[model samples]
Target chain A: MSDWAQLKQALISGDGEELCRRVRQTLDQGVSAKDILNQALIPAMDVVGERMENEDMFIPEVLMAAKAMSAAVEILKPLLAADDLSAAGKVVIGTVKGDLHDIGKNLVAMMMESAGFEVKDLGVDVAPETFVAAARDNGAQLVCLSALLTTTMPMMKETVAALESSGLRDKVKVMVGGAPVTRAFAASINADGYAPDAGSAAKLAKSLVQ
Target chain B: MKSKGRRGGIYRPLTQDQVETIHDAALTILERVGFTYESGLDDLLEMLEGSGARVDREKARIAFPRSLVEAQTAKAPNRVILYGRSEDSHLDLQDDLVHLGTGGAAIKIVDPENGTARPSTLKDVYDLARLVDKLDNIHFYLRPCIPTDIPEAAYDVNVFYACFKGTRKHVMAGVNNEKSFHDVLELAALLADGMDALKARPFFSIITSFAISPLKFCTQSTRIMREANRHGIPVALSCAPMAGSTSPITMAGTLAQIHAEQLAGITVCQLTQPGAPVLYGGIPGMANLKTMGYLGGAVECGMMNAAIHQMAAHVGVPNYNSAGLSDAKIPDAQAGWEKALTIVLAAMGGSNYVHHAAGMLESMLAVAYEQFVIDDEIIGMSCKVLEGIPVDADRLALEVIESVGPGGNFMTSPHTMAHLHDEYFEGNGITDRKSRPKWEKDGAADAWARARRLVERLLSGEETPYISESLDRQIRERFEILL
Candidate 1:
């Protein structure tokens, strides 16, 4: 099989160890790290993201693909410089404070990466300042905040305001989602967009960047 | 020395020893694998310390308190009557065919065809109210949470008012806090015109949860349960403990743990008021260890509901379990088989009330707006099964049978219409005997898609009964917010 096709097949099946080994082999064979990522990993993940959007892929499959992609990305992270990484737009994401839900945020982050974006996953229970700092430090063009609990949704709005306060609101468009988030809430919070699911979140992120 | 027939029919009451064994098994669950408490960690730890249970401070795991278990068990009620907004809506505790109506799926729909499944709008709430009003078998309505879009505080109040306006029957809703609880009570009081009226007719039941490990209660939820009980309002203590996680892997083990937790809540309610109305409601589902997911399939959920119903019957308290639900979306063969299996067993096993009778799909991860009609049909079929075989002479109707004779259609018989309500439940919208050409002419809408159109029809017009604009504003303004 061709090297790109082999890597694409490996990523789709979530062969994490194989993905890492293949990436290393491709790089050793004089293939650029950027080429391996753009040519093999990104396009493969885009297909996975599309499948998830069409309901052809469910939680477990998407999760596996994300894990495999993460393994492949880890191998390439050091080789690609900050400027080289911007081929995919930079996006910052986190689960708001007082809510420990990370699965939805993680899924969105995975899909975003698959759709060819560099993601700064801030992890769960992230304070507002933490998100603002992540966006600033990563030069992120888009901010995605998620909160699953009804009690913690206010934190998402607070994070958005913090971004605005830091004069980063216009520079970085903000989006929010979770079980409790609604398009009405997004409009109320003055968010750039709201996506109901992980796949939609990725699509919205791509659209925002463009 | 009894005959086989006599032995088969004999009532071998559960011995005190057998009850103690069950009690012991539950205590083991508490002592071994502690229950998960989201809030109230500090309070639960304190309670554990007071009850002489070993507490792991960091993890908040507590060893079981056997003495406390005995004390709580002593206070649990064997039976109680649940009241509605009117005395006429009361559900009597007995072994009979009782069809507690259905509630839609609580989860958000990710991909809807026409209308968006954004956080539930007022339109969704109003539509649900009207649908509940139309379903005859539904004795009570459960205000399923529109979790995604609306503010939880406003969501609670909106659902309570909707249910109150739509039906004179009872409801199960979650109040936001003490203030919301007070406001709902005040509204109920107004509808009845005072505390006396409220006592005579309890419109809604607040759900309470018990601390699983040491068998204690959360301070706020317990407070609401106590207050509701003091005012003679019924409560449903939902102990949704996950097996292999919160309780035990074994079904029997999980049930005993659930029983102990429910008894703890019941004991507290009775402590506040001796004859406090309460429903023994819990969904102690066993986890599929391989998948680490709760199997919401027919066999597992059906058995769980049946077991709980059996235990509740032992106490003579009405059961408010869930039924007419399926793991499938769209009315496929699996949906049909599972829905039929769930409702039939739950109804025949004598569950006094079952919620989730319609519009739930994907293991309750989403509510299919269109599936509600199909679910209603399933509820009707299950209720029909519970009617049992009518052997009476009037039902036999020898003369009517003679006129119909062998191989004759009952459609033209005069006796058919007379016993129609008794013989069969008339299906709503879904069941049809139309020929292909006629059916094709009318637009062949699938059950799910048809339910969607039905929901739109219900939502289009008609204000809820007796809910004046002034009263609604009064109820909306009433709030008790903490933090």
Candidate 2:
């Protein structure tokens, strides 16, 4: 089969070694890095994601598959940078202050990357101002805040307030998520958007950026 | 110390007398003021008549005997071990706290391409079973809902049977259906058949839920409960009321409504077969008035769970409640935060039983596999909290403290090793122990991926309790022909 098909299969089957080698080979062949990424790698992740949502594959399989895609992406990163192929959008994401959990934020970030967004992961225990500074520094169009605690949902509002106070609220949209955050909560906290999971977050990020 | 007004929005902390007062008030309403007739509760009146309760058949109002309620409440286990369907399935419910479980599938469908939101199947059942097996704090497994795979009519029974195969010790929340109930009993009898020779006991019991608020029972669930009672099986009269929908908006009002419903359930069970065991149970959720969405982990829901547990204790009945459920989606900070608060509060509040230990989100409309992993960790924390402060001489560790007191590290100390097993909390298995570098080296893992790995490991490595092949065939036949 063609090189693109080979790359796609590597992604679907979660073959890390082939993914890395093929990604580097594609780069050496002077294939446009963006096309290799958007057409081959991202779409492959999307397929795996779809299979996951459908239960055709469970989490371990999807995770292993994602790992392969990640390895391929790692190999393509410097080449894409050298080619000046910038991501579609920049976004900042993290679980808010006083919360140690990061899985949801990490998942959203992974899916966001797969969707072609350059995500600056702020990590857990990110203060409100930290989120604002990251959004400003990264020139991120969307600020995604996650909190898994009921007590800390109030902090989401604080983060929003901090953004609004910093005059960056108008330039950037804020998206709040986690188990306790509802669409109504997003609205209540004056957030730009809310998605329940990584898969939906990818779709939401795409919509917001566009 | 008597803080006035609402301390936690929907809930106001109450004294033991106040909680009992609420229960009494609800019982009086159930007996005298009566409740409205929903689609299925009309049968409750007939059932009451059959059970020798005074039912105003014309109005469908029933007067329950207080003595019967008290008696059935007494028969309920203050604390009982929920055995798995095999030698492996049993967790002792120490009268101090409730254990939580995740939902069985409510709806099933065809699998999707993405690893998330996929249509559930029997494989999903096996996946969840393994997840449940690794959860020491989960203590119980709610038949995780999977409606996409099975027909809607058979969803409950199918999920229950699937979970039955996954667990060996803890009680599986089997469906409360006439057919499924009988099928499960047959499976139980089969498992117990050879136990007489070995002096071992059977695994599994029946847990039937009821709709509380406008006090009554669903005809189908009631029939199942009646049959379960007749068979001398333990019953959990779970009354889940979405506040402002089935229950009044106020937490006190909601609590009273549930109490009356629970007492009515107790009365019905007793009248069915005097001395039938039934847990004073409820799984009430709060309603978000603005969105009309139900809230499961609201502070009010936790407080109500505590109050109900206290009420059950007062009547000398074991309690069942909703705990360890976070409204947050994904196992993130909000999920962790809410789960931690609720689990800690409920465990400390004298709850004898709890539900929703894992796999719930979006007001319980869905279950995230990763969240289950996080919840297990939260439950581990709660169990540690439940273990309370160890006060033994070794726990004091004066010598260890003095030996390591000045500047020495305790990491390699003999005392540290001696106490570490009992003193240190190893966390529920879901926690990521690797450092950031290691995590990055391993591809920046997430809870969903970890939980998936854990589930697979348990399914492949652990031997879940299973009935004999002959018994298994018999169960399949019964479900095929009878159900």
The TM-score leader among the candidates is 1
CAPRI classification of candidate 2: incorrect
What is candidate 2's lDDT per residue for B389-468, written digit by digit as tens?
A: 66877877888888787877889989877766667577656678899999899778786667666655555675655545
**Could you tell me every candidate's TM-score relative to the true structure?**
0.71, 0.62
Query: Docking category for candidate 1?
Result: incorrect
Off by over 4 Å in 2: A1-210, B1-13, B36-53, B65-81, B85-88, B92-94, B108-115, B153-157, B174-176, B194-202, B401-407, B446-449, B459-465, B468-483
User: Can you write out model 1's per-residue Cα lDDT over A1-210, one digit (the tens) per residue?
Assistant: 299999998999888988889999999999988888888998898888777766666556677888998888888989987665566699999999888888778888878877778889989999999999999998999999999887899998899899889999989989999987999999998999999888878888888889
Candidate 1 lDDT score at position B193: 69
Chain A only: give the TM-score of model 1.
0.86
Please state every model's RMSD to the true fold in angstroms. 7.5, 21.5
True contacts kept of 1: 0.00
lDDT of 2 by residue, A107-168 (tens): 77877777677888999999999998899998899999999987789999999999999999
